[model samples]
Target: MVTSQSTESRPSLDYEAVIGLEVHAQLETESKMFCSCSSGYVNSPPNTHVCPVCLGMPGVLPVINRKAIEYTIMTGLALNCTIAEQTKFDRKNYPYPDLMKGYQISQFDQPLCSQGWLTIQVDGVDRKIRLNRVHLEEDTARLVHKDGPDGERYSQVDVNRSGTALMEVVGEPDLRSAEEARLYLVKLRTILQYLGVSTGNMEEGSFRCDANISIRPVGSQDLNTKVEVKNMNSFRAVYRALNYELERQIRALNEGERIVQETRGWVEAKGITVSQRSKEYANDYRFFPEPDLPPMVIDRAWVKEIRDRLPELPDARLARFISQYGLAPNDAVVLVNSKPMADFFEECVALTGDSPKVEPGQRARAVGTWMLGDFSKLLNAQGMEIRESKVSAEALSEMLGLIDNKTLSGKMAKGVFEEMFDTGKSPGRIVKEKGLLQMTDSTEISGAVAQALESNPDAVSDFLSGKEQALTFLVGQVMKATRGRANPAMVNSLLRKQLESRK
Candidate 1:
C-alpha cells in the first residue's frame, strides 16, 4: 500500500514559515475596464486593442465597467466577504512601462469587499484560512522582451491587455507548509471556475499568483522579513518555489545570515528563485481616489440577489457525492475537483438510469472506477480533458450498462473501450463491429471447455489430487481457447463438473 510522506521522518526544523498569497484573476469581461476596446486580445497583434483611455492619452475621462463590479461582488460573496456599502476606485501611482497612465486604478482605504474566510483541508484535517480582502483593479499592459538582430535586448509594451478587469484575493499568513499552500490555491481556483468570472487558466495568464513567504521561530508571533515570489505559471511551480524559498531562508538563518525583504522571480529551469528587486511598500504606490469615476453604493437587495444565485461549491458537492452516491471520500474529491468533469460523470450516471436494477452503492462504485481508471488514463495520455475526449458520456454509460447487464464481460469491455476512445464509436457499435461479445452460448463454451480438459489431463490430475489452484489453471486455458470471450464463471462451473465426472 502507498503512504503519504510524514514530516516527522525528516530532521525537525525549529522555525516555521508564514505564507500569504495574492491571487489576481482576470475577469471574463468583453470590454476594457474604462474603454470600449475588446479584452479578448490573446493572439491579436500588440497595440491593436488600444483606445484613448487604455493608451494613456491625455484628457480621457475614465468610466467604470458595471459588469466588472458585479463580477467582483459576486466573487466576494462566494468567498463569504462582506460587500462595502460604499466603495470607490483609487489611483495607485507607479512608474513602470506596463502602467500606461503612469498609475493603476485600484482600491485603497475603501475596497469593495473585506473580511472573508475560506476553509481548506490538509492531511484530512480542516482549517480555515482567513481572507484579508477581495478587491478589484485594472490590469496593466504586458511587457514583451526580445533579443534584437545583433543580440541587443529591447522591450516592447503591449497595451492590448491594459485596463482589463482584474480581481485580487489577498489571503492571511495562515499557511505553514507547501502542501497547505497548494491545497489553498487549488480550492481557490475551483471557486473561481464555479463563479464563472474567470477562466482560471494559469497557462493562459488569466489567473496569476504572487506569494509572500517568511520564516520565523516557532511559537513566536512577531513577523519577519518576507520575500515575494512571482511569475509562477502553474500549481507545481508555486509549490516548488515556496519549498525552495523555505529551504533557502532556513539555511540562511542557520548560517548566521540575515534575510532580506525583496521581490523574486521563479526560475523554473534553474529550480530556484532569483532576486529581482526590493519589495515596495503600500505607500510607494501613492494611492488616491480616482476623480473621474463616481463612488459605488451597493444596497441590500443587490447582495441578496447575487448570494441567492451562487451555485453549489466544491465542499458541499463533495459531501453530497459521498452521502447520496455512497462514494468514498477520496473518490468524491477527484470527481468534484473539476466542475466540467464532475458534470460529465453525473450525466453518464443519469443515462445509465443510475443502474436502477443493481445496488446503488455498487453502481456508483462502478461508475467512479471507470471514470478514475481507464477513462482518466486515456485523457492523460492524450493530454485532453473529458469534454475533449472522443468518447461521450452517453457512450461510456452504454458501455457500463452492457457490463451491468452481463451483455459484455469486464475483459471484453476493456478492448471495446479502447476502440471507442480511439475511433469515437459507440460501445455497442464497436462491440458489434468487432464481434467482441462474450460467449454466453452454452454449446460454444462447452466445446472450448471439452477441448481444454482433453489437452490438459495432467492439470486435471492435479485438481483431483486436491490442488484447488489447478482448477483456476484449467479455467484460464478455457478462456484462452475462447480468445477471452468466454464467461469466466460459467467456464469454472463446467470445468468443475467435467472433472468430478471423471471420478
Candidate 2:
C-alpha cells in the first residue's frame, strides 16, 4: 500500500533509481515444456491444445522437452552465462486459479545459467547490467476477466498457454534509469530473435517483463524497499511505468512517507501504478524438490556444441557493418538493431558490386541513407517491416546505381523511390514512364537557368549585389521550373556563368 503525506517543505535530495528486470521469453518449441501438447496455441481455441498432463489430471507424469532444454542452454550461452553442471526442478507451491497443478516446476537453488552480464548503451555510455540467473520455468494458464450480462463479473481460464516452456532472465539491480531499462529489454529481445529461440514479440505475450525498482539517495550503498511493476506489455509501457514508479517513490519519501514493498499493476490508460498485493518471497512459495522428476547433470560437451551453433548477434553485426562498410556508428546501430533491416542493408551493398564510378564506402553510405531515410519513413507510415516492403534490395541497389550515373537527380530519385515503394516498379521503368531523367544537356539547363533568372529578377539582382544566398534561391527556381529534372551541378554551373556574364 502506498500512502501520501502532507506537502511540507523539505530539502530535496538527489536520488538514483535501482532497477532489476525479470524477463520471461516463451521458447520456440513444437511441444510444451513437460507435456506433448502443441505449443502453437495462440490462435487456437481455449483449452483445445491441452492434454491430460497439461490439464493437471491425476496419475500423470511430465516429461522434459529436450529441445526446450537445448534452447534454454543456447540462450544462456548467447548471454555469456555459465552453464550449471547440475540442475533439477522444484515445485513452487502456490494457490492460484491459473496454476492447474497448484504448483509450478521451476529451478530454485541451481539454475541452468548464472552470473551473466549484458551491455547496454545510453547517451553514448555503455553500462553492463548483470544477470542473476537465466533459468527455465513452465508458464501457467491465462485468466480472462469479463463482465457478465447480468451485471456480474466472472473469469475464464484459458489453459492453452499452460505448460509452455518459459525462460526467465533475471537481472541484477544495475540499471539506474528507465531509459537504461528499456534499452536492456530491447537488447535482450534482439539477442533472442537472432538466436531464433523465440519470437520476442511483446504484443503476443511471447516476451514479458516485470521490473523491480527502488530509489535511494545518491552515493548510498544500502538498499531500500522495492516495488514490483507488472502488466506492461510493450517497451514503451515498461519505460513509462518505471519512470512513474520512480517519481512516485521519490515523492513519497520526500514528503516523509514510507515506500511499501508490494506488487503493483500498471494501468496504461491511467498512466499510473495501482497496488496489487504484497510482494511474495521464496519462503512464501515453499519451493522444494519435486519427487516426480529426477535430478540431471548437464554435459560440458553439449554446452560447447550449443555455443558453437550460436549465430552472429547484434553487437557483432554492428561492428562488422562499421568496419567493413565504413558506416557511421550511429547509422550502424540503427541498421543492426533490427536483424532483417541489417540483412537488407548488406544485401543491397552486395548487389551494388564493385563499380569504378562509385567507391564501396560511398555505395554503403548511399544504401544506409535510403534505408534509414525515405524507406524507413514509408515503412513506418504503413506499419510495415523492411521485409514486408514492396521494394527489394535489388531494386534499391539499382536506384542507387542510377543516382551514381547522373541519370536521376537526387530529388527525381526520391520521387522514383516513392513510386517504387508504392507500386513495386523498378527505378528504370518509373524514370522512363515519368520522363524523370536528369537534364544533363548543358543547352537545356542553360535555357532553364535563363528562364529562372528572367522570372526572379529580384533574386538575380540580390545575387549581383553580393548576397551569396540569393544564388541558392535562384537555383531552386530553376529546379522547380524543370520539375526537379535538371542536374544540380549543371544548373549551378550554368547559373554561375550566366551571372558572371551579367556582372
Candidate 3:
C-alpha cells in the first residue's frame, strides 16, 4: 500500500465521533426558482436580481424554472435516491426580514428524493451512509441588522438571494470518525460536480454544509443531546470542527455536565465551537401552504430520464483505478480525490502508445508519486490545479523517459521536471539548457571519485577497513566535486569497486 503521511495519528479517544451533515447547495439556474428574476445573486449589488414576484408584491405570481427542476432531479438521481414523482412545496412560515413572503417555499412532507446511500472509504475500508432525503426549496433573502433610532435594532432586507433555488441533502448519522466525515463530504461533492448540479464552491456560498455532532460513550445505546454546528466552510473545517467538538463533549460528559441540544457556530480561528441560538423545534417554524404557488406534479418517466443521465461517480472511478490500473487502495484514494489530476493521469496513459516503458501497475505508482510529491508541492505554492498547470501529461512522460533510461539521475531529473513545470518545455530541452543530464560516464565520475580518494586518505582507509558508512562519506565528497551532477547510484557502485580494490 502507498503510505499517506500526515502529522497526527488517529485519535484513540474514549468516545465515538457521531456526525451527520446537512448540505445546502444553491442551484446554478438561469432564473430564480419561483420568479422570473436572475438567480445569480452573488457578486451583484443588493436587490439587483430581485423582481416583483421575488419581492412578494401583492397580486404577483410565481413560476418554476424548468432547468432548475431538471438539475434537482439530476442531483437526486446521483445521490442514489428514489425520486418522488409527485412532490409539492409547503410554506415554512417563519416571520423574519429574510422572508419577504413570510414563508419559504420548501418541500417537507413530499421531497424530491428519499432513501439514498453513498459509500465512502474510512481507514481503508469502505462504509455506506444512508441519505435521509434531498429536497428543493427557495432561498431566503439577505438580512442586514444594524442599530436604528431609539436605541433599537432594525433589519434591512436584500431580495437578491430570495427565490434562488436550493437543494438540501440530509445524511444519516452513520459517520463514526473524523476521517469518515471528511470522506463523506468529498464523495458528496464529487457527485454534485459530476451531475453539474452545483459549483461545489464553499467559498462562494454555492455549496455549504452544517454538521450535527454529538458524542457518547463507546458502545453506548443512548444518544446524547446533539449540537448543530454552523459556519464551517471547507471539508477540512468540517472534519476539524467535529473532531474538536467531539473532544469537548466527551470532557463535559466525564465531568458530569449535561449536554444540551443547541446550535453552535464554528470558531475557525480558535478551532472550537461557540454557542449560537437554541436549536429550533418544528413548531417554532409555523408551517402553511403557499397561496401564490401551485403543487408540482412529476412522473415516473421524468425520474427515469434523470436516472439515465447520471454521470460516473467516485466509487466507480476508484474501482476502475484498482481493476484497470492496479493502483493500491491508498493510491486510488489520493488520485480520485482530485478529478483534474486523475484526468491528467488518464490522458498521459493514453498517450504512452503501444509498448509502454513499464507495466500498468508500476506506471500508476510512478504517476501517483509525481503528482503527490513534486507536482503537489508546486500546485500548493502557486494555488493552481492540475488542469490549469502549464505542464502536460506528455511532458511528464518524457521526463519519466529520461529517468527510466538512466539518462537523468533522480536528483537531476528533479531539476529537469521543475524547470519543465515552469517553462512547459520538453525534458530534453531543459536538460540540454542546464546540463543536468546524469554524468554516468565512468571517466568523469571516476575522476571525481579519484579526487575524493586523494583528498581523504583516512576516509579511503576507513572504507578499506570495512566502514560502510565511511564509503557514503567519500561518495558525498565526490558528489560535491561534481557539483551534484554525478549519478548517485553509479558513484556508489564505483566507490565500492575502488575501495574493494584497495588493501
Candidate 4:
C-alpha cells in the first residue's frame, strides 16, 4: 500500500524533478496498420476483428496502411518536426501476452519524424519541451484480467486492438515538475486533436501516456536514475502520480537508498507508484529491419500539401482570438485550448451580428464573459462538454441578444439560459413560457421603486445621509420585488429619481 505525504509534512529538499513522457495515440485510421481489419474495435466483441495477418500467422505477409503514415507525417509537421524522406519499419522482439505477433513492427532508428518541440506555459512562463521522435507502430492486444468463481485470477487476450495504428511521441527530458508534464501532455493532445489524427481521449485508451521521472539535486548537472510510471489514464492521475513519485524518490535519497531504474505502475486509488519490472534498454528488444515490409519514400509535394491543409492550431487560434475578437489574452488562451470550445465560441460570435446596438467586439466580449462565467459553471456542474451541451451556439447568441435588447435582465437571462441548457429550448420560447421578460416599462419600474423606498425607510434615510451602499440595498429590494425581471439600469434610475424627490 503506497501513501502520499502532504506538502506540509514532507521534508524540504534541494531537488528538481526531470520528467519525460511517451504518449501513444491510436490513429483514427479506418483499418489496422498492416491488415484490413477494422480499427473500430472498441465496441466489438473480443477476437472478432482479428485477421491472419494481425495474428502473425505463418506465411502471412503484412502491408502498410498509407493513411496511417500520412497521419503520422501530418502530426510531425504540426509539431514542427523534421519529416524523414526515408523511413523503415523494424521488428521489436518482445514476449508478452498482449503482443499478438510476439514482436511489433515499429520504427526504430529511422522514425518518420524527429527533432520537434512544442511550447507549454507553466506558471505564466513558456517553456519549449523538445521531442525526441514521433514514430509509427502497431498497438498490442489488450489483456483482460478477470477473477474466477473459485477466487482465482485469470487473464484473457483480446486481439481486436492488436494491429491498430499507434503513434508514439517520445519527449526529451526537459520538464522540471509534474505540472509542466501535464501541460506538455495537454498541448500535445490538443495538437493531435486539431490535426484530426486521433481522438486524444485518454479515458478510452486511445491516448495513453507513460512517464519517466527522476530527481537530482537542484544544481546538479547529471541525470539521475529514472523510474517509468504507467497505468495513469487521466491528466490528473499523471500529475498526482508524478508528484508522488518525486516525493518518494526524495525520501529514498534522503535515507541513502539507491534509486533503481525500473518500471512502475501508478495505483490510482493508493496515490502512489509500485514497482513493476526493470526498465528495458533498446538492445533488450533486439530491433532489426523488418523484411516483410518495404521502406517508405515520402515525397516533398505530399508534405507540402499536408502542411498547407493543416487547420488553425491552438497557438495560432489563440493569437487570432485576441486580435480578431478583441478578447483578453487570458480569456483567449482558455477558449483556444479546447478546440471544440473554441469552435463553439467562434460560432456564437458569428451568430451575433454587428449592429449599432451591439458592435462585433462588444458581442464577442459578452459571449466570452458568459461562456467563461455562468455557462461554464453550469456545464461543469453537469459534467458536460460544450459540444455535448443542450444549449446551442444559436441559443446562447439569442439569449445574449435578449440581454442586449433589454427584453431580459442579466439575472433573468441567467434563469432563461439555465432552462435553455436543461431542455434545449429556444431563448425566446423559454422567456415567453416562463414570463421572464424584463420590466422595462418606466411606470411599472417606478411603482416598484416607490414601494421599495416606502417599505425600507431606514435604507432611504441612510441614502439621504450620503451612504452610497444604501442605494445598492434599495436596488436589490426593487430587483427582488420584481422577481429579478426589472432592467437593472431602469431600477437604479427610478430609485435615484424617487430618492432625490424624498430628499
Candidate 5:
C-alpha cells in the first residue's frame, strides 16, 4: 500500500503492502493423482473422465501416481527447495459441492518440499522471493453455472477435472507491488515449462493463482487484516487485482472504514474484486492425517539423483547465450524467454557451419536478428507459434547464408523467406524459381545507373552541387529498375562512378 504525500501543515500518510501467492499448477501426468482416470479432460464431456475413487465412492483404496510425485520433486528442486526425508498425505476436511470427496487429500504439516526461493528482477534489480512450502494435492470437480428456461439459474457439476494431480507452491509475503507479483509468476511459469512439468496455461485453468494481500503502516512489522483474492485466471488479472485491492484498502483507511478479512473474487468484466465470503482460517479446514495412505521415507540417493538430472535453467542459459554466442544481453533475454524460441535459435546456428569463410558469432547474430525481427512480426500477424510455423531451422539458416554470400539481395531474401515460411520451400529453390538472384554484374548495374542519371537530372544536378541525398535517390532508382534484385552496394558504387565521371 502507498499513500499520497501531504503538505507540511497536514499529516503525511504512507503505508506498505505485503503480498504472497499460492499458485496451483496442474502436473502433466497422464493419469489422475489417486485414480487411473485420464487427466486429459479439457473439452471432454461432463463426468466422462471420473472413476469410483475420484467420485468418492466407498470401499475403494487410493494409490498415488508415481510420475506425479517425481514431477513435484522436479519442480521443488528447480525452485531451490529442500526435499523432505519423510512425507505423507493429510485429509483436509471441507464440504464443498465441487469437492467430490467431502475432504481433499493434501499435505498438511509435512509437505514434500519446503524452504525454497525464486528470484525475480524488477527495474534491473533482482529480489529473492522466498517460498514457504510446495505441497501436492488433488483438484476438485468443476461447477458450471447455466441459465435455464424461464430465466432460472441452474448449476451443473463436471467431474472430469476431479482427481487431477495439482501441486501448490506457497510463496512468502515479500512482493511489494503488482509488477513484482507479475514477474514472479512469469518466471515461475518459465521454470515449470522448462522442466517439462506443467503447461502453465491459465486460460484453460491448468494453472491457477490465489493472492493473499494486506496493507500495514509504512514502518510497522505487525500484520494487517488480509484479503484473499481469487478468480484471477491470467497474469494480467493478477496484477490488476492486487492494484485494485491496494487502492481499495487505502481508500477504506482514509474514510475511517475497517478492512475486513474476507475472500474476494476478481470480476474481470468489472475490473474489481467483489467480496465472496468470510476468509477461512486454518482451524476451518480441520486438518488430520489420512488413514488410507502410509508415510514413506525418501532416500537421500533418490533426491540426489533428481538434483543431478536438473536441466540448465533460464538464468544460466541467458548467461551462456551472451558469452558463448556473443549476443547482447537484451537480445539474449528475448531469445531465451521461450524454450522453443531458444532451441530454434541454437539449431539455426548449428546449421550454419563454422567454416573459415563465416564467423559463428556473426551467424548467431544474423539468426537472432531474423528471429526477433521479421520472423517474430510474421508469427504475431498470423497468430501462430514458432513450433507451428512451416519454416524449419535448416531452411532459415540456408536463407541467411544466401544473403551472407551475396547470392541474394537483403530485400530479395526477405521475400524468399516469406515464401519459405508459407510454403516450406527451400531458400535455394524459392530464389531459383522466382529469379531473385542478386545482380552483381557491373554491366547490368551500369545500364540502370545510366537510366537513373538520365531520368532524374534534378537529382544528378543536386548530387553534383554537393547535395549527398541526391546520390541516395539515384541508387534507389537503380534498385527499383532491377526490382530490388540488384545488389545495393553495387548500385551505390556504379551510380557514383557514372555521376562522378560526368562531373
Candidate 6:
C-alpha cells in the first residue's frame, strides 16, 4: 500500500489529516435481516421478541428477507456505487456476549455494493468524496450490564436486536474536515429519505456511524495509522469525534508519541476518543461463507427497476428550487432536507400562487421564509411532524392570502397562523371568530388615525419637528389602539397624511 509521501517540512513530523467513515443504518423493513422476527420490538421484555433463529437455537434455519436486499441495492445506487452482480453473507466469528451465535453474520471479500461516491458541500465548496463499499449485514444482540453497590455485577443479553438487517457504508479516506463529514451525512441521509429506506434518525439508534481519523503531512499522499472511532450516535458527535481525534493525533506527533492503530470509543460528553483495546485483525474475525444462506445474484432488470425508481434527489431538487423558485442556496438546503417540508412548501404554492407577499415569485419567497422561519418553530414546539401537522396547506394559503389581499396585517396573520396550527381551523374561521379582521378600509383607518393624532399631539409635533421615526411610534400606537388588527400599511398611510397636515 505504498504511495507518495508528504512534502511539507517541519520541525516535527509533517502530519496531515485523513478520515474514513463507516455508517450503519438500520433498514426500515418490517422484519429482521435473516429471520421472521419483527424489527420494531424495541422496549419489549428483553428476550420476548427472540425466536429460534434469532436466539441461535439449534434446528432452526435463517431466511433472507428480499426487502432488505432491495433496500441495500437502492442505497448502493444512491451512493453512485456499482452494485455487485453476485454477493453473499459471511460469518465473522467472535466471542462476544452480544453475538449469540458465537459469530456475527456480515459481508466480507465480496460485498453487495462498491465503488460509489458521495458529493457534499464542505465550507461552501462542493467536494466529491469516494465510497469504498456499502454492504448488507446482520446486527448483533444487546449487551447490558448491571452492578450493585458492593461490586456485585452481572451481565445480561437481549436478543431483540439480533438478526436486524444493517447496511454498513464504508467511505473512502477522502474527507479532510469534520464539516465535510457532517455535510456528507446530510446528503446521504437525504437520499435515504427519498428512497424510503432507513429513518435516518440517529437518536433512535437506527442510523449510526464510526469515524476513522488520522493525521499526516499537509501534502501527504501516504496514509497514517488510522484509529477507528465508535459509539458516535449523531452527526454532531461524528464531527466532534473527528475534530478531537485530529487534535489528539497532532499533539501526540508533536511530542514524538506514536498513535496506536486500534478502535476507540467516542466520549461525547467529554469530547474525546478513548482507547478501547488492541486492534482486531481480519483473521481474528474468522471469515467464512454463511452455512445457511446462499449467495445473492442481482439481475440487470431488477437493477434497472431500482435505478428508475430513484426520485429526483436532494442536490438536484435544491438546484431546481434555486433556479425555479429563486431561493437562496441555504434556504434551498433547508427546504430539501426534509421531504415533508418540501412537499408542504409546494402545496402552499398550489394554494397561493407561489410566494406569500407577491403573486408568484414573491409568494414563494414568503412561503419559504415563513415555513423555514416562524412556522418551523411552531411545529417544533408542538412536537409535530409536518405531515401530521394540523396546519393544512389550504389554511396557510388562506392566511397568507388575507395578508396579500391587504385584509390582514403581517402581525395579525402571525396570530392567525398560531390559531390555525392550534385549532386545526382555517385562518378565516379563527379571524372571524376572534373579530380580527384587519382595519384596511379607508373610513375605519382614517377614524383610528384621527384619534391617535388628537390623543398624542406632542408625538405629532415631534414628527413635524423632523424626528421622522416619531411617525413610526405614532403608527404603532394606532395599531395598539385597534387591538393589533389594524393594518400597518394603512396605519403608516393615514399617520403620514395627518402628520403632513399638522405642518
Against the hidden true structure, what lDDT does model 2 obtain? 0.92
> Any idea what lDDT model 3 has?
0.81
Better of 2 and 4 by TM-score: 4
Candidate 1's displacement at residue 301, Å, is 0.9
Q: Give the per-residue lDDT of model 1 (tens digit) for 280-303.
A: 554488788899889989888988
What candidate 2 gets wrong by more than 4 Å, as runs, is 1-9, 277-283
Give per-residue CA lDDT, model 5, range 423-464, as digits (tens).
999999998898888998989888988998999999999999
lDDT of each: 0.88, 0.92, 0.81, 0.91, 0.90, 0.85
Q: Backbone collision count in every prediction? A: 0, 0, 0, 0, 1, 11
Runs with alpha carbons beyond 4 Å of true place in candidate 3: 1-17, 35-48, 142-159, 277-283, 289-292
Comparing 3 and 6 by lDDT, which wins? Answer: 6
Alpha carbon deviation, residue 171, candidate 2 (Å): 0.5
Q: Mind giving the per-residue lDDT tens digits that candidate 2 earns over 378-472?
A: 99999899999999999999999999999998899999999999999999999999888899999999899999999898998999999999999
What's model 1's lDDT at 371?
A: 89
Q: What's the residue-level lDDT of 433 in candidate 5?
A: 90
Better of 2 and 3 by TM-score: 2
Candidate 3 structure quality by residue, lDDT tens digits, 1-503: 11112224333345686789999998888888988888776888898998888898878878878888888888877777888867777888777778888878887888888989888876667788999999988888888888977889988888899989999999998888777888888888877876777878887778889988887657775666898999898888888888878877776765557888888899999998999865355446666666666777887887787778777777788899889888787777778777777888878766555645667667667777888889889988998878788889998877877777787877777778788789888998888888876888998898998889989999988878878899889989988888778889889998888877787
Q: Write the per-residue lDDT of candidate 4 for residues 87-189, one digit (tens) a residue.
A: 9999999888889778999999999999999999877778899999999999999998999999999999989999899999999999999989999999999
The alpha-carbon deviation from the true structure for residue 31 of candidate 6, after best TM-score superposition, in angstroms, is: 1.3
Flag regions of model 4 displaced more than 4 Å: 1-13, 277-283
Report the Cα RMSD per candidate.
Answer: 3.5, 2.8, 5.4, 3.1, 2.2, 3.7
Q: How accurate locally is residue 320 in candidate 5, as Cα lDDT from 0 to 100?
A: 99
**Candidate 6: residue 237 lDDT (0-100):** 89
Rate residue 9 of model 4 by lDDT. 47
